[model samples]
Target: MQPPSKTTPFSLPVDSDHKATKFRPFTISPPHMRAFHLAWISLFSCFFSTFAIPPLLPAIRRDLHLTAADVGRAGVASFAGSIFSRLAMGPICDLLGPCAATAAFSLLTAPAVLSASFMSNSTSFIVIRFLIGFSLANFVACQFWMSSMFSNNVVAVANGVAAGWASVGSGFTQLVMPLIYSFLINTVNLSSSTAWRVAFFVPAFFQTVTALMVLAFGQDLPDGKYKRSSNITGQISKENAFTILLNGLKNYRGWILGLTYGFCFGVELTTDNILAQYFYERFNLDIKTAGAIAASFGLANIVSRPAGGLVSDEMGRRFGMRGRLWSLWVVQTAAGLLCFLLGRSNSLWGSVLVVCCFSFFVQAASGLTFGVVPFVSKRSLGVISGMTGSGGTIGAVITQLLLFSGSSGNYMSTQTSISLMGILMVFCTLPLTLLYFPHSGGMFCRPNYPPTHQQHYDHLLQCQ
Candidate 1:
């Protein structure tokens, strides 16, 4: 067997160092926040690559001479890869570390991503897309990293920012990809196929570089260090990977959270892929114009998703575990209504406005769902996070399969179906209020002491 790696997990921090024993919800200097920063960058690369194809779909269709059914199948194919990849990654992050999990995915998928630039037919392109989908697992690692590095009280907020900011790539790509395509077309005098092909190269370069950065500088804990990957410790590594995965599968609450995610974050993913196409078809807008509208929906995630986390955290301060549940319930219910409204609106800008509102609540609901994730089982956080993250993929698949499928689903019928999906979101929120998650202050108030695994959080939060 290979010798034990030198990168052993750092022993727990000393308690006498009061400087390392407090909490700060809004600071840039803490180790947890540092981890958060790195995590977002890695997660951003994954999202950027995952979404790179959608905004360019219109151009791709024309170039390849593909049917609408082909595009819809590609969307399904992307998320289908995400579902299984995330399920498996939870165990990998447990065995490896977040930094390894994130970087490995980034570097491993790079060749497939770059090769997509050369695919001339729908079959090869769809296969390449499935390969790209593996990057979505970075999201699970991103959250697992944050939970390891932060306190329970503030974890939701940290998760919110990391997830929210990382998601900007999806929206930003929608906006940015078009400009790249346009620049190549208008300035460099490239054909539609060639211009779009070059755009994939941009994100491919960033992903490879960022993955290296994470491997070089990323940390698995908040103690300001990273040792050899083989030196890892913790619940993720405390038990066998298979046993840990089994535990996650048995945790029904996680399954419920995953279901809720199917609607909220699922809508985000589905919309990210289809919204541009919808605008292009309904308003007869050019790809650039429709893409801009869709990008607006994605950009809303910067503030909106974090807002949900902040709200959940505030609720936790006041109501403990119940607050997190309440916040998710209220926001998702609102999101469902907004989806209904989005489907009904006929005006060009009016529909865009509805999408923005829908984006906010759905994104917020996603943040709120995660607020409760870490609390599920500290030892199983990796598996739990992966399972929960997969929930979004499930939702996206349903939406595309039902509302946006090329042959069976049409734009004319979208409004009614969208409104119905909203109601489903509202109903999903109802059960959480009764489902118990151990919390502070007697379930309705802040606890005098923190929950399990929170002592380390306090240590990181404490300022010298």
Candidate 2:
């Protein structure tokens, strides 16, 4: 066997004193707190805007007199915009750096959200919401930035924090938006139209504030921080970028992971977006009760993500087990079964418990899904992430379509459809377990081949 290469991409030089020097200024002085605070603040802002649209769907529907199909169509529009924006933004992030890209997108998203307040018809509403999704596509930029700043050892925690914060946005909207709506109706004496407008305005104001923070505090990451293929040549040409993305698509591992994400997120969006409506119809619960129950998913997701990462790391160290992909499949399958059972039950409290358990598993799976991303292609993390995220968006849109058409504006029909989707989700994981986990090792390391071969291409495409 050849001697171990001194410059293995996976290996990092250990420096005991280097850690001290790297953290000395931050630990000894309080100034480092600024970076932490700003980072989290920016993250929270992104999270808030990310979730703001879903929770307000009911309010928008009622105020605009839109049908359930209209609502679904609007969601599709927004997701389509997000998909397109991510495709463009991924390469831009790789070229321009995440800081400038995030700032630009954040500023652009603010105006889109603000303009949403003025929408009067479904056509205008759909257009504006799509624009909002396009602008808020800065989320990909933020993730790339975080990956560059934190080392691999701490990357799990950093990513978990960002994801957890994003999940919290749902709860924040649930807790605050209804109250704001009530106040607008009761105190401000506004019409339903204006009340919903104010709700959009609230997130817009916060988004603008976050944009300013990003502009002031965000910094470009140092070059050559993350892993990339050594054989990558040329100066990040546009052709090179497209080739990287195309390679990821051709790679079976990437598409398999993407499919897994698509199914899981499809099920997740179905349950989350429609949970309140399901409870309200099935159990005769009020909107408030339904909102509280639905909010549990986000709360559980936020808690489960970091826990999943910790567990993955511990298992890897102790048992040499890198079964995260399989584990997620199992978890989602179990959750699907629980959801089916919950749908069959009549007791409100019993349904809530089952739903909570389902949420926990789904969230855990969510965390684990992303936990494997950095391992896929350290160089092409951003573009790969965007591609996978786009798949999830497609899943979400499909789920929305199913919910829309099958519901027929009837509650019982919707529940039945949702239960069937859950069952389908359970089976979706089987192929993932058999195909993905067994081959995960290939994803973690670069292929050994001649530089001129297409099969040996470097993964890094862009930062933004």
Candidate 3:
């Protein structure tokens, strides 16, 4: 069977016959819905395979006999591996094309994730986990795919839904992995040790399956369904990859936005891993309870992050470029304050409530950051995506170092450190609203881009 026609697969109406079509839930039809649907799965799988470790931390620590700091280091190592690798994802995705890149990450990472089933020692387990981080580069590809399919006016909403939905896996895994592990033990009669190892089979299988499905069924462009021309163009030159990388990193806005993302998404990555343990220690709860509470942090991303993007989209209409910037600052600043308040809370439920609030703003900030990312430069979306995506991992690496370095990392010490990190997040982001980008479409004092769409492939295919 052939792929569907890409000329606005969704039977939705277009405002201009010569411009890109806009899709909203109310007006969405087939097959654009098909592309949008699968794109989120690509992103969901990237994180599902990469972060599958944290939700299983209790089993991981018991099987490996690791200390708390050792667990923290293991999580840090995963982020450390991703910091630079994610930067490479953009150019690589552009070079390989998003469809190929998405499928490739799934196929490539499956073995590494599945290998956890046979690990004999902490060293091997940690090494395998670190390698899994490489799959996170798929995130750049997923975002770039959305940018290609949607109009600029609704891109933020599209990105937020895609990212927000993908992020749910973190929390869902937290709530579910324990159940999966238990099912393996009780139903299959596997030993507790073996159950943990066998549990990884789930992520490995899902990862591979999702990849094949996307490659087989997904479309790369809107004007033509399942076209391979862009994929062929991606392979034409290795030199093109380096050029894209350099151009992406050179954008000062990418750097600032990346840093801001470091505070939100990066912190979320670290928090996802640590939250389970933190709750276990701070509230003296069992691993199951702690993991469930931690899952709540990620669960909020489904709605909160989209709210951020929707807010940015609305702000852009009212305030232009500054609106996106303003939304980011406000959400992030609120998140910073929530972090401090969370640290000071005296009761367990009190802290958990604050954490839910914190989760909302932090995840929303992530959506807002990406809302602005595409506007940085159309020619370099892949590069910018990688650069900004890496920022979150970079932030996780730094946060882990600073938070765990000087302290024994007890509950109080951890809270105090996070509060300080919150202060730092605000200070770091303040200069961004004042900065500007001119090349993409702005002035020195203000950065703004008029939202416009193309009827045919342009920014994505113009990679020469």
Candidate 4:
């Protein structure tokens, strides 16, 4: 049995490389779909743990006597913790495989999620938030797992569906946290402080259970466990992890995609932190009401991101890489405009409508970004995924520290900061125009050598 060549239009059932040509998301059978289910669900629990605090911030602020400055710094610290972890997770994935990487990281961070319940002061609160944030690196593992399980043709959709479903955890927390808090206070008769504190136990438990599930059920590659190659001396040095790391770093496309991801996914992270507070203060909504509205932004990922992947694939079938780039540019541009409008809207209803629309485009842009990622360099996929994934946290850190961080004393008003972020997002989309490949040309040009039906996947072989 041989791997599919440059001219093979479709793969055989369970091809020699063990990658699946067709994607059947509903089925949870072994190899492809089973990995897909575990990958997204594990990351979803991480997302749940990472963001469990934001919706409860109002009650937390009063109980802990936290000022605006303290809250701002905590937000920055949460995103900051993930930045380095995301960069490191890439090489770790290459060395250890996504299954081991995800399971280990999840277990390591689960205690941090539980620790959030014990923090009494702002300092301890900030530290616990930082530790819990390390789980976000699971995102890199999720993307890496999907790339390993699916073939080139369906990889975009696989990546999109996996990531999109996992991101729903952000919204799920927004909606569920408030309800749990209400249940504790109303039904259990616990005080507000105790209710919020005890609520932490739920996500912590959820995260721990999911991590164990991955360890017991998940496989690294489609066929089985990841095996390392041996050198002439029979020492296990077959794949030089450093060379894989360096090769991915050398590719210019990864950097461009990383920068672009900052605005879309980074903005999403920043919003997840601030949105409930925004509606609470600006609109005078109750805690539960504000959380439900905030959840809408994240829940939109269910359809929006997959739509972006679907549209990108359809465009690629017709216009190759150029179509993918153009669709990304257009959709992201709309997201920026809506973001600006969201800040400027005066009424609560109007703002909510704008936010829902903004969520769609911004999340779709994330899906579109990853749709191009797997094609960058198959050999260095983990490294490239790490670079792009880290870029999102970096973007959130900058957005938080400079614009949303009230501790800075010179930070802009929240509304003004959001509008300015929109302007920055528009500028970020410009880099997508600069990306090009050998057989598939860029935004403004046509390919010098047009590809045949099977040659469309040739970019999987080389970065250029």
Candidate 5:
């Protein structure tokens, strides 16, 4: 046997497969921390690429003469693409490992982002947005990678931070794209249209670069890249890809979690698509100002989502899965209330404050939702993650269609639609209260249920 890799000597807590128990954000050594950084950064680039257009939508709308219907359609299309791609990405991760799957996906999607500059009509804009949205599938890989690299005890924090940082790309692009647009118009002497188009090249380039880096340097498991026959510790290698996916699909918990994710992550996606435009139109703010405010919503993910995971993990340690469920329900319910208030605020500063709070809770709810995911089924982690991820996109699609779609013939005002969406979120949280696991129970279920045989087996594995 070959000698152990140099990075394997760290004293951090590790499990049977040597998956890390502690989450060190600054750590860059491979198989754990290195994978953490690469996973988040790779996902970050994809988020950036997918959302780069939203901040510039005002300009695109004017240039393309897009109606509100067209705009809503484009938003739906983007999430729709992500829904399908994320579903596919789960099994892909199971087959090739997240590293290879992510790299290949990024390379394939970057061209679509580049092609954004060519959008000349409503149809083309919607189609291009749809294609660019495929990059969000990297989210599944990011979460799967974190779960694979860290033990269950610290996995929430790992998943939270990785997803949180990756999501910052949405906020980062919101803040940066407008500045780029302004620079091109004011300094580079390009027209507004040309400048926005040129800005696409920036995210596309970064997406390509990050993809190449992951492909070259990223590790799939603690030991090495994934192999079909290799039995990596903490992972189920006996199951084929199809079997893995079917197992995940058959688990009712995955469906419940998917619905929970829809209201949290799905609402977040819809907000990202429309918030800048909302601020611009409602408050009469310039693109830069509106983008900046909207940026606060996405940027909140940096802290808010991780905080959710931290809380979930802490609760799990203290109160078991019931704690995780309570935290998810409480946070999500508050998010819905805040979301309702966000639409009702008449003053600009009030609106901003409510949105910031809403961001914290909604994103935190996302973190909490995923905190429960790894426990759903380790054997089918990828499929369950995919289902939940796709559920988020599906939620966005439904929200966009039901509320924001101007095709309603008698379109409700944007504010009213937003308020209505909040009510829906409140109703959605009800499902979380009903989810029960034989091992740890749920929100209203008995917390002291006797451990099932599988639970005992899992506990033994954790101890070993």
Candidate 6:
């Protein structure tokens, strides 16, 4: 299929006399729905491994005789691996397609995680964790696969649903880890080291299972379905991937979206990964309590992501505005402030409410951030997504470091550092919202050129 010509906004060349022609709507089947379910499960498994480790840090530290600073360094190493892998996987996905890439990367993840299970020291653990970070980049490939399979109108919702489910992995680990720990201690009469090994092994086993599932059942869509043409006149090179990457970077829309993602990620990571440890130390809470509180963030994420997408889509139709993106930024900034205030509050209930509120807006912001990606460059969705995702990972890396170094291996200092980061996030919201909404037709509000009647029909059928 030829690429849509760069014509006037929302105009596509067609045989005017053929306007009356009836076109059969494309329909998805039971198999396709099954594929989507498995893909989401695979993605959830991947995320469980990626996020489950952070909450276990205090236990790992106590068991392994490690320092708070060392734990933070481990986070830095993990996110650093994510940064590089995101960059590498983007082009790989664009070239090889999402299914093969997802399976390949997921299979690689199993061993990286399994290696962590046997680490004897902090250095070995960090190295294995970094590799695990690199392997978990398969989540990006999953995103590409889901986006390609779904129609544009509902792509945000699909992404949201996957993201929401994936967040559950963290919550699941939080809820299940204690049980697993208890089982190892009481039933198996295992040592602490052996119990930790079991925790790591569970994710590795699931990752292996998910990889086999993908290899067996995953199907690649025909190239014509989603691959954008590379032949933009004097603009993008067909063979040079770097040229395409550079061109995407040059686009103003891409940078704006990337910045929005970066800011949101920085704040979210600070709270999700670092704050639990900070709270435990500062308030003298037990490891289990801190983990439970942190798990609430995931609970909020599971609910808010789909709500954000549904609200965004509805608002887009009613107001002809991309209120989802802009509104989320403003709301998330307020949530960050509430989190900062919670850090200062001595009341436990106040802190919990603040954290829950923060989680709600942060997850909503995440959905809004990804919701705009397809609109940026329909042809180069994977590459564009990779760049933005890389930016977010970079933000995570920086925030992890800031929280780490500022902690100075002290509990009070860590809490202070986190609050300061939250303040910075508030400032970040201004530029992001301004850049994201230019007073022109905003990202999600802009009419899709070359109207996808088949997509609309599919959405309509789903609605019915």
Quantify all predictions' global Cα lDDT against the true fold: 0.78, 0.60, 0.76, 0.87, 0.89, 0.65
Predicted model with the maximum lDDT:
5
Give the runs in model 2 whose Cα sits over 4 Å from its true position. Answer: 1-40, 53-59, 222-240, 319-321, 405-412, 434-464
Give the alpha carbon lDDT tens digit for every residue of 253-370 in model 5: 8899999999999999999988999999998999999999999999999999999999999999999999999999999999999989988988999999999999999999999999
Tens-place lDDT per residue, model 4, 259-284, is 99999999999999999999999989
| Candidate 5, superposed: residue stretches over 4 Å from native | 1-11, 228-238, 447-455, 459-464
**TM, every model:** 0.87, 0.79, 0.88, 0.93, 0.94, 0.82
Mark the regions of model 4 whose C-alpha exceeds 4 Å error after superposition. Answer: 1-16, 228-237, 452-464
**What does the lDDT read for residue 292 in candidate 6?**
81
On a 0 to 100 scale, what is the lDDT of residue 8 in model 6? 18
- Per-residue lDDT tens digits of candidate 6, residues 1-464? 12224751112122221111111112223233444566667877876777667766766877778776668778888778888787677777777777778778888878888887777778986787688777656657766766665555566666666666666675666656656766887899998778877877888899889889877877655222224344334343354566556656665766666666666754665466665676677678876787788778776667787666666555555543356566656666776687577667667777778778878777777776676675566456677778777777777787778656435644446656667767766776665544432222453445342244535533332221
Off by over 4 Å in 6: 1-32, 222-240, 406-412, 433-440, 443-464
lDDT of 1 by residue, 158-216 (tens): 78888998998899889999999999999999988789998899989988998998888
* Candidate no. 4 TM-score: 0.93
Per-residue error for 436 in candidate 2, Å, reads 6.1
* Regions of candidate 3 where Cα sits further than 4 Å from its true position: 1-10, 14-20, 25-31, 225-239, 405-412, 439-464
Residue lDDT tens for model 2, 1-464: 11113753212222221111121112212122233344445655655565565555667777677776666677666666777676566666765666677667777777787787887788887787677766545656655665565554445454555565556665566556666777888899998678878777888788778778766765554333222333246343444667656655555555566666666654665566567667766888665666777777766756776565555545444432245554666677887787677667678898888888877776666555665665566556667666666666666667666654434555446656667667766776665644432222322333343335422232332221
Instruction: Please give the distance, in angstroms, between residue 257's alpha carbon in candidate 2 and its true position after superposition.
Output: 1.5
Greater lDDT among 3 and 5 belongs to 5
lDDT of 3 at 63: 78
TM value for model 5: 0.94
Q: Model 3 clash pairs?
A: 9-31
lDDT of 2: 0.60
Give the least accurate 10-residue stretch of model 6, judged by summed lDDT: 16-25
